[model samples]
Target: MFRFLNIVIISLITSIVSAQGYYDVTKYGIPNDSTFVGKNAIDNIIQKAVQKGGGTIYFPAGKYLTGSIKLESNITIFIDAGAELHFSDDFDNYIPMVPSRWEGTTVINFSPFFYAYKAKNITITGRGLIDGHGRNWWNYSEGFDDKKPKSKWENTFFENNKNVLAPPDSKWLKRGFLRPPFIQPMYCENVLIEGITIQNSPFWTVNPEFCKNVTVRSVTINNPHSPNTDGINPESCSYVHISDCHISVGDDCITIKSGKDEDGRKQAAPAEDYVITNCTMLSGHGGVVIGSEMSGGVRNIAISNCIFDGTDRGIRIKSTRGRGGVVENIRVDNIIMHNIKQQAFVLDTRYAKSTIGPVSERTPIFRNIHISNVTANTKDAVFINGLEEMPIEDVSFSNIHLEAENGFDIHYSKNISLNNVFFSGVKTSLVKIENSSDIDLKYLKLEKSTEEKPWVSAINVDGLFIDGCRPKKGTKTFLQLSGKTTSNIGFGTNDFRNVSQVVVKDYDVKKDAILK
Candidate 1:
């Protein structure tokens, strides 16, 4: 009887909340005509809903032009099936430089089209579209374009500083030059964005910064081939879940970041506990990318059951020196890649141009990663380029198959293990090892192409072991050793066919290099 009474009480509360009725923007003096600007009317409606202890603000089947709409706690913005929210192209609409983070650095800039701050239990859901007419923004970023007119804000800002034409190379930029994101929620909790079609974002489409308990599902993102138009970027947030989304953008489909070089270390809020599954990626720079701005560190990430087609890179992790961070405990499984233009799997420690110096806390660290059950047809199979001062550590791959134009490139790494891995249709050496140590390969198979190169080449490697490796037919030399520092290489019982020489020294080094 107590449980029954509790259920009845909860149902009564829910009904009472629903009975508050939808606060239509048209009823609040906002017209459905496209000529009228609905910014004030929408803001008034949102305020009215908040005053009523939270309700739904509904937009029925029309095109509503607005500048920026701020959301409040316990409020839901619902657009009907045929309704479309069109953002104004004028730069003055996003005024009064709010406190925002631009690409991992904190600065006061223009407000996003849809902005929410420090609010809870907020949602934006419907079958309608939120469009950012971003052609003018994109053109201004690239320089003067004949198709777009110069905005008054742009003209005034540039007129004061006649020498400055565009944004500087630094990560942090002043106001009046930074383009805003489409939808941004900062320091909010219990956020849910579902079933909305977002297109032509000025910056990243949907960015949630410093938020928690966020869930984005069943959304569609379509950004044109413009600069910095990423699909969904979650920065310095925790407990994020993104699933069942279709994304086609110019930059990375889904990028996870914390912060940038010096500013990132100060914030020290790592992006953690993320789960991305059942997503389709097409025409992006990378399917899923981590860092370049991950100074606060990233951990406990799991990606599974995704498809990447016509992407530049399938899975990528990149960081440079001076970005002090540690990325660990990552697992990716059951991924399929087709027509990848670049490497299928890449861990680049030297992502961009940076001065090399002594190892310190500023140096980035990537380790403790496991990938399995992956199949890729790409141009390059795998590329691991770690820094010499701080090498990548403790990574493993199992049950993987790849067909690529080139092969694996491993450098400055340690404790790598590969089992049941196959490489086919490779024109270059099947595996190239450089400045690495403590490697193990088991049940490895290599199929050669027209280019007759050594199947395995090692330089300055120590404690290398190979077991049950099957080389392709008509191979002259199975192993090619170089550099004076190479030592302690061993091979177990393997299948060798039509090979003239088992080991060949490419340089004037020690003769006692191989052990069987």
Candidate 2:
């Protein structure tokens, strides 16, 4: 897709760790035939590479059936154009659980499908396929829908770590022995994953945890409707750049996570400085999602030039009360979404049900996010709900158009700005605002048929401003304001052409609350 920047620099592969060499797997006595267990032969090749300081482990055109492969420092696994590494489906091969983060909490679980720990300058690239035979894992986990029983390992994990897991997502213990990521490099530096097509991940595909200076491009991740098989997730990492990827997964297409509630708060490392662009998303829950797992924090991300087709939402940022994270400084632009199943965009703070406690370190925050130049054909659009105690702040939208059945539903948010926006095919009201203040709507457009109801409804809103929203044909009572708390409403230079009345106030609202 982005061929100009398609290839990784050679120094990224051969430098920063040691001298470089090349070792072919076939020369190590593993036949081209795919039947043999390739664990020993691949490990032998890796050992030779480590002995020579660093090298490229080559896999030529054929299938190699293997179990978990541990990556080492200063190494690259370059699969030829037709080569495929087919991971085994047996759960036992991944066991004697390793210490890794499962969902957000740290636990000893299955070895990552392909993993490295604290390594440096590692690369896995080439035009080949890395397939995780994930059907067995899904049948063991998400197959609860088909009425299957939990495996023995599930119970064993629950018996081991049940005391330590104080979960906002407490449901993890029930499934137990959590599924491993398709590819994970933990605590690594200068990592690059590119040009490979991955399929049928057991859990999240292309997940790098606690890694720095990571880049993933030109990769294709296609997983069916199994459970928790997200396409690409970068957790608690810094300086990440993801581009030119195609994803159609069972869950979210690309998600950024810092950590879970308590464990993440202890680590306190925010995932920062990410640039994601030029990606195509087909089927998933959300096109780009940030957290329900953010307890440490997430900030400074820019996403642009993306296409989301047949996904559930376009941009989703979610957190609960107990996960105390701040998601801010996010910018999304030049995006197209088609056939969105649910609301196209959302920033939900009360994502999970925890007893509403005092505003402490556990309270999550969302602020200073800007989205522009977006077009979506969705069922519903723009659902943003924040906590009453700590509302979402400083969110702005410009040049947005949506063809949808329903429209914006905003609650407990402040400092909102919508400029040059159009909502077409809206069966219900265009906007519904409650318990929010300082909302400015400029150049707003909507299509409405039955004119008895109000097109714009606001309740308990203060400091509302409407400007430059003039259309040729308009209905009576365009805006309806209610609630004793609604005050300081103003209209600036709006043409109410072909309309009888423009403002309507209920008994609760004072007449002086609105000014034009």
Candidate 3:
């Protein structure tokens, strides 16, 4: 039966490749052995294939070193097992600062090592390696000798400094601020990247911006935990499928961002219809992140069957007020997390440089988020903070066994539901909602791990509900409601009659004194 299944799969793949039209790179001077300096050879082959109206460029079994290469339309690059393509580290070789798009605008800048622009039907497939030789670029200005540590470059933080802007003033200057991506393709369509080992990027790896109909499968992207070295960042792309990829890097493992604020809002192009499954994230800021730079808004994203280990956070969505974006229709399920240092989930709406600016129409809005079936050990189970002027709405959490040290904190939100959620903490409220409305908690089991730190009922909200909930033995202050409604007509003690509806069942609750 297994043999038959393998045969069927092979037949399907063969059919697909044959239909796509294959052209071997060896015919264009790419050597089968590791000794050949086939820099221009394979390039000529690709050009020939493009001139002949599209085909595949197969790299079969060798260590190939070359400078920057551009991919044309309707061409596929297939690197077989035991093949490695090491990019040239000499900055002078990558000349002219070609016409490329950075962030949002098209500008004359350093081209990506492997880039495709406004092209269609491109694929980079097979089990091989694309090494970025980043240490050479990182140490390009450090004046390090051959005797220095091979891992020294990975320890530096290059993204924070503002000196290295995109399209550096001169190639000779060591402006480390620019985190040059390894494999980037912008404004392309119908792209597929699968089954490759991509590593050692000087900046973000595997970035596809402003693209469509993209698919990334069975790929391993690894970088040495350097600053701004995010993996598989799909920005401003639509109809994307990223599955079976193991990403471990310095920054967010898989960050989904649309665009920067102001510029991104003006563009008005949302990154939508993306699905990520069967992936693993080892160490990073967040396992799967949706951006602080998402000014163009993001919607319709689903991530399932993922694992996160030793990350700062998991399933994070970050944006700021005045960013002018909308993030909605997000679903995350079937995740296992271990050793998460921060909150399991975060919805931070004030992410940028804080300022006292008038709430412009560009202020962002977050709603319709659902997370379920997650088992995590973290510091905080959840943290949701919305701007007072623009509150988040319609969020739900179900089937979560989150063991955290800091419980949960929510502020300036509405219409939240927590079902079948268990929290183990002490000296803190199992849940706290401040300046919120329509909050519901059902089947909540709060356990106290320490007696000195008694759990407190310091939650304050409007229209709150507590049904089928179990409180720990040391829980203090059953419930408190404060806020005036109407004039001099306090209804009853321990019950809020004039205020909005606040219901608590299967437990005792405190009532406020009526004032007339």
Candidate 4:
């Protein structure tokens, strides 16, 4: 039934495209010398295309400076190589707010520099540049304060019972939750954005919301090291294929987000079945981030053959307590991280802002995660902290080699498995597991970087299994509670003198030994 539904949807879209008239952009409007400079050439072309039933609007190789350019159905805007389509810096040029999506809400938002909405079979493909000319707008939006560092985007809420309020002093507009996204294409389908250098956006770049069959490949995304400049944010979309792309931005290189909190839960629209492969991220906050805005929930994501260099964190999955959603069945493989500043792999569920609130409807769940063959040189090897109230489960980490400042820290989780993993840290504990259950640690080696602080062990689990692992003796310690020990089992060369309930196979027994 679902397959049939998909087919019907595709057919309906095709019919709509056929019904629309098609016109070329250059034929409808020409860029002459007199009207070329400061002329609304792009708007004129788009209007003509819309009037004549949308078709491919071509941008030939030259510099075209204008304000916001709107896209229509069946319109394919082709930007050839050496073409530089720049956005005007005047704010009033983008006035008359258009229907758009900001943060998570659907509002009459400020239009993107290049905007498209509810369009079909739209293609913005070429080896050219679609520069947002964001520095002017970004500076202006932040009140043009050069002395202080500015942000890429800002979020503001509407007060006074859904009425549009102006910027004021007392009830002044403070920063809201949702950051504005750049290159926004909302409710668009059959989209193809290939081989374009989409850069310098004022905010999060390449945002495709409620879109489908979107193929973004061979694109180079370069932005300033500012706040909220994400490369691509595919929110509430499906069948997305992102490959052969080079992303270097201020925020997450490629982030997948849905909605946030109660607003997200009410939407209940998941961003599912997306594939990202063979991509390289040069510098960013995160290599790939799956949101705290996932109120609509996310599932069935696969990422492979990715390289992260000089990033703050790699493979980061972060969410708050109240955001209620389930992010499961994620598979990441063949990842290589170099010079990661923070934790190489992290699942932080305690992303709270106010530090106090009820269990929000946006409480999210992360489980059934499988990661393998990940090599990294970083400050911290691994960091996984589930919600103390709700434990994360069914996670596996295998064949990971880390050269870092700290070791693994796993807390408040269940059904955890670690195999063939090694960590080398001089001043920190090699492994620390607390308030967990069914942990299977096998073929592990925790080596000391220097003799100052040797390999220290802190394992607190209900059921634990240690097999074929090598940890430095004399300094390794274990602490436990009697009621917490369910089954402490080991395979070869077992050391369980400090454990409460212990069973060993082929181990030299040292009875009444103090574990430290």
TM-scores for all candidates: the values are 0.90, 0.93, 0.81, 0.81
Residue-level lDDT of model 2, residues 180-282, one tens digit each, is 8999999999999999999999999998999999999999999988788999899999999999999999999999999999998988888999999999999
Which one wins on lDDT?
2
Candidate 3 Cα misplacement greater than 4 A, ranges? 1-21, 32-39, 99-106, 139-177, 425-427, 448-460, 472-477, 480-516
Residue 148 local lDDT, model 3: 57
How far is 500's C-alpha from truth in model 3 (Å)?
26
Instruction: Please state the error at residue 243 of candidate 3 in Å.
Output: 0.6
Candidate 1 local lDDT, 280-319, one digit each (tens): 9998999999998899899999999999999999999999
Which is better, 2 or 4, measured by lDDT?
A: 2
Better of 1 and 3 by TM-score: 1
**C-alpha lDDT of residue 85 in model 1:** 90
Best by TM-score: 2
True lDDT of residue 80, candidate 4: 83
TM-score (C-alpha, index-matched) for candidate 3: 0.81
lDDT string for model 3 (1-516, tens) is 999999999999978875566666665666665565455676687887887788988888888877677788988888899889887776644543554434533344556777788899988998999888777656653453434544322223222222323322233224322335777888899999999999887677888888999999999988874666788888889999999999888889998887766557766778899999999998789999998767788999999999999889998999876567889999999999989988789998977656545677568889999999999999888899888777889999999898887766888888888888887653466676677777777777665533332222323455665556545444444444434321121222232222232322222223432233
Tell how far residue 218 is off in model 3, in angstroms. Answer: 0.6
lDDT of 1: 0.85
What TM-score does prediction 1 earn? 0.90
> All models: lDDT?
0.85, 0.87, 0.73, 0.71
Judge candidate 4 at residue 255 and give its lDDT: 90
